[model samples]
Target: MIETIVFDVGETITRDDRYWASWADWLDIPRHTLSALVGAVVAQGRDNADALRLARPGIDVAAEYHAREAAGRGEHLDESDLYDDVRPALSSLRDLGTRVIIAGNQTSRAGELLRGLDLPADLVVTSGEWGVAKPQPEFFQRVLEVAQAAPRRTLYVGDHPVNDTFPAKAAGLRTAHIRRGPWGHLWADDPKVMEASDWRIDSLTQLTTLIEG
Candidate 1:
């Protein structure tokens, strides 16, 4: 039985529309252009941040992030940013006695904002806080530590194949490839993703059913 359900923030529990849109605004580029570039990079298996680099070649994204913060336009998250199914799904899982956790490749600020939302999760953490990102053995090690459960009893859910399905599977966690965002849709049916994911879900709501089953 799966005792814990760990989620990826971007494109999993949260929609990234505002995130990319804010970047577009900051970079002074058309939102569509940046969105398209993001899709392109995902298609090529490149880092999502490459979209920003593509928009402004040789741009220092880290520096620009600080610049945006200095100008009072840093990361922002709110209830509206969450997928409609997030609360209901998480609440349902918790109701089933499943330990729900939200851990993703997000910034420390994103972690704080997510915690501020007071979702039904037992824990909400990010790569920035852990000092390790996904697809890294150390990151999954931290997840295992926090879960306090055997790897097989933990289920990791996310949209990205490279960052989510593959490594999580390698860490011995049952993986669910959630089909929601760009990477989700693009790689949902790919052979490797299908192979890596123990389950493929179209919505977070399916997780409750998964746990019950």
Candidate 2:
């Protein structure tokens, strides 16, 4: 029986479009510059790791982000709210005897957003705190350890195949592919990859039934 769940935050529980849309505006950098930098790092082309390895780095983006959350910022930048089904679905799962945990690369900025909202997270593991990012296999392992769950009995759900599905699949955890727009093309229609997921849902509302099954 499924007993635990390790969820990703950004696109999973929390709606992230608002914060991202305003990140460049607050940084005083052109959106294009920020986009290029993030794109380089995300695409693994510019070598952010190399840059950090060269220097211990005085600034931590995650830390600054946490501080921002503590300061009660991001409200002005944010407009849209979290998904309506997220909390009720999670609550239903918890009521069904599932212990839901969080595993993501986000800073504790998640706490800031979530503290005000009525959400439930049994335990949380983050890349900022774990020193490792998703799809690394170890990320899910840590979550399993923290949640006292065996991979065979737990499910890891997230919006990305490479970041969420690949690692959880390798770690022996069941997987749920949350298909969203934006990155849908690279993965959405690929039958081979889609076949790998235990379940695929385009909306969080579908989770209630998927998990119930």
Candidate 3:
């Protein structure tokens, strides 16, 4: 039985594409360019530090993520509109006997973004707090410890195959890929994710059936 359901923050639940698109200038790249960099980082098996070198520092990536949400009369709105089915869906999962949590790459600004949205999160695993990014086994270990969960008993869901799915699987968690969008343009392909994810879906609505089946 799956006792815990963990999520990758940006795309998995937060609709990250819109958020990041607003702040693309800081990274000095186009949407496609940033996507290429992420892909290359994953393909080369670079750690978070290495990824940072490619992206550069001092740009406040977190604030940029929030800026998009707060921009232009807030058509999309703040984190409040992150995922249309977020709170209700996660709450439903909790009602069905699963604990829900968020594992994200967030700094203070990122935290502020989430707060502005009024997200009801049980636990958060952040890169700023941990000093590491996901897809690293150590990051998963920390998550398991914080949740007081055994990897085997957990279900991890993420958008990226390279970072979220592969590492989560390696850490012994059952993995799922929420492949709603074309992530291929954004992240490099990794065999580890290519080989080991237990399930893949274009929507979280498909997840419950997979977990129960």
When superposed on Cα atoms, how far off is each prediction in RMSD?
0.6, 5.0, 5.2
In order of appearance, the predictions have TM-scores of: 0.99, 0.73, 0.70
lDDT of each: 0.95, 0.66, 0.66
Worst 10 residues of 2 by lDDT: 47-56
CA lDDT, candidate 1, residue 150: 94
Greater-TM-score candidate between 2 and 3: 2
For lDDT, the strongest prediction is: 1
* Model 3, span 1-213: residue lDDT tens: 788888887667776566444434545568676656655665565643344356665655446555644654222437454667677777677667677778766564565556566655577557777887766777888778766668887888887776777788888898887764445333424455557777766666665666566
- Best-performing candidate as measured by TM-score: 1
lDDT of 1: 0.95
Q: How big is the positional error of residue 44 in model 1, measured in Å on the Cα after superposition?
A: 0.2
**How high is the lDDT of residue 75 in model 1?**
93
For model 1, name the residue pairs that clash. none
Stretches of candidate 3 above 4 Å error? 25-77, 184-194
